[model samples]
Target: MSGSSRVLIAEDDVRLAGMLEGLLRSEGFDVEVARDGQRALHLGLTAGFDAIVLDRGLPAVEGLDVLRRLRDSGITTPILVLSALGTAPDRVDGLNAGAEDYVAKPFDIDELVARVRALTRRASAVVPTVRFPGGRLDPESRTVTLDDDTTTALSERESALLELLARRPGQVFSRALLLEEVFAAADDPGVVDTYVHHLRRKFGRSLIETVRGVGYRMGSLS
Candidate 1:
């Protein structure tokens, strides 16, 4: 779930855009490049990017304008704005316009990667109040509380998958469905299996019953 997902980068600077794309790819991210704000808005609206690396100064439409439009359209993908206009007002403006974070130009690649990672951690996350027979899964904080008041913390992906299963305690969910709803990695269905394995290890195998030829579900603990 970390660094193995898609990211869209919107930068008008050809060299900077290429650099950002290459950097993200080197870190194992699926990269999409948009050279201007209009294209950025189009891609941001239609495509499902885990996170966006946006530049404040873009052709056609400014990055902040794109963010405003996306927000208006109810697109909540985390945006990290990268710009050369490094000023208190500029950073404030970018953040105020709906960017989750701002990075001034000529920034350290590692720092940029760190910011991107943090933003993705939040975007791909699910926070739902999901209930099963004897337990409740809280996605916001990634915690599972049992009927006995015992609580166990889960990772982001684990919590998301658990929340999906908890929604229908006895109903089975196939790997494909889980991939679509929980894993957020539609390219690989096998990722669901890994998270399911993690869930089994965390909450005990009996809690999640896997149908031999089918899929898995949250079973009654009572």
Candidate 2:
């Protein structure tokens, strides 16, 4: 692959998740993992990823439910469901819930890789980014540059948060929701506000709009 695919693994099985991560990394794919469904949904929604491998059974939220909600939110990223149930109905249920492919547990690693590659091949032609009048945000590089040709690097959390808001300019994201999506419930909601403040200093106060009691939104990039 000329470019590595950003893949998310939302499996509760720690052993399996580690193995998958190692295998995917070895294959030149950028991989990240979530131990439960909540983290899966958050990271999947907020970050820019090429494809997802979702486990049907997960804690905090079920994998199927996560898939459904992701689809509902208009995120059309390719998703492959991993499940122990491989009955006709099982595959049907997963497909009906918006999974692009279904793989029963105990799958061949090589086959899994092939399936993931297939999903990326069919991924939609949408590249996520946020641009303002004089600056642009690059999700992959985690950097932002302004009109003056000056650039600033962003922390992982900052990049994720900015990417999410930039993808939907003018859409106000509440602090709590931002925390969940960007920090994955691992950090406090205050982190959202703190990062917003930090970004304002770098990108200008107007670029990141505060929604008063609500959350924040990307200012007019045009």
Best by lDDT: 2
Instruction: Estimate the TM-score of every prediction.
Output: 0.58, 0.61
For candidate 2, write residues 1-222 as lDDT tens digits.
446888999999999999999998998888999999999988876776789999999999999999998775546678999999899999999999999899998899999999998888776454544554557777778898776778899988888887787655536788788878788966667777788888887766886887788878777433
**How many backbone clashes does every candidate have?**
0, 1
Q: Give a tens-digit lDDT track for model 1, residues 147-196.
A: 89999999888887776666444457788777878767568888888877
Worst 10 residues of 1 by lDDT: 163-172
The worst-scoring run of ten residues by lDDT in candidate 2 lies at 124-133
